[model samples]
Each structure stands twice: as C-alpha cells, then as structure tokens.
Target: MNQKKTIILDLTGCKYFDELHERIRIAFDFPKGYGKNWDAFWDFMRTECDAEMVEIVGESTMPKEFLPQLELMHTVLSDLKIENAKYGWNFDYKIIS
Candidate 1:
C-alpha cells in the first residue's frame, strides 16, 4: 500500500488573507519569496508543493468576507488535482466544515 502525504489546514482561527496565506505557506514549507497572491498560490500548488493530498478544515467558520479567497483556493486545488491525474500521481483536496 502506498501511503500518500497528507497536510491539513485548520482554519479555525484564520480571519484575514495574510493570516491564511502565512499559515498555508508555513504548513507546506513553500520556498522563500512566495508571493501571497492567487497566482503564486496556483503556481505553488501546481508545481512546487509536494503533498499528495491537502485537507482544509473549518470552512464554515471562515469569515464570509473571505469567500472569494476561498473560492480561489478551491480553483487552484481543482487544477492541481487535474494536473496530478495527468501525470499518474494522486493529488486531492477536501474541505470539512
């Protein structure tokens, strides 16, 4: 059985964009000079980060004002999923409320 790496992002206390970005960057150990933006996030997810699966928790607790940012994250994760599938690698994202 191949066990894939899993990283969980608990958003229980995340409130702002910067906070969310910092938490994710630090959790995944993204390289230095990681721009805290959607484009950079997509790049990292698609080519830099190494985890086979990522789980984001506490979505229901996230601030409503951050909906757009959350959507962007979902989009990036979806793209990564597709990219990984093409390479015969497993990459997945899940959200738990």
Candidate 2:
C-alpha cells in the first residue's frame, strides 16, 4: 500500500470568465477570432497531450469563484480540448535517446 499527499496551487489568479479567457488566450495564443475556428478547436481537443502532464508545474493560487478559469485550464490541458505541441510552440523540446 502506498499513500501520497499532494498540494495543488493555482497561480494564474483566475477568478472569473475574463481572467480565464485572458489566461487561455495568452497560454494558447488563440487568434483574435478564435471563435471562428470551433471545428479545428474541437478536432485538436479530440487528439492532444496535456501541458501540465508533460511539463513543469507552475505555481498559482486557486482563487475562489474561478470555475470558468479552472475549467478552461483543464480543458486546454486535456486531449479533450486542445493540442499541447501547438499550444507551447515557443518552447524548444530536445529529445534524448
């Protein structure tokens, strides 16, 4: 039997829809008219890796009344929402064999 205790943090200060949207926009660099690409968005959602799951953990204070922000983060990170490789394109990934 193994027991582990984990402490989670939300440093994005996402406490409302606006904050969440801003975070999403900045995090994923969504176009100004991203709403027009719902199909592409949905397709990416169906096939993508999670950002957090494959990268470093950020520090954020979980703000109350930030359901929208939280949901956006979760959605974008999971394959059910967006593509990870495309999301963090600015970062360079080096493969070691």
Q: For this target, which candidate reaches the highest TM-score against the unseen true structure?
A: 1
Instruction: Compute each candidate's TM-score over C-alphas.
Output: 0.91, 0.39
Residue range 1-97, candidate 2, lDDT tens digits: 6332222322444455554444444444455554423344444334432233222123244455554544544553453323445665321221111
lDDT of 1 by residue, 8-61 (tens): 988886898998888788878887688989899888877777898898988788
For residue 53, give model 1's deviation from the true position in Å: 0.9
Steric collisions counted per model: 0, 4
Model 2 Cα shift for residue 35 (angstroms) = 3.4
Q: Model 2 — which ten-residue stretch has the worst lDDT?
A: 88-97
Q: Kindly report which residue stretches of model 2 are placed more than 4 angstroms away from their true locations once superposed.
A: 1-11, 36-60, 68-76, 79-97
CA lDDT of each prediction against the hidden true structure = 0.86, 0.38
Mark the regions of model 1 whose C-alpha exceeds 4 Å error after superposition: none
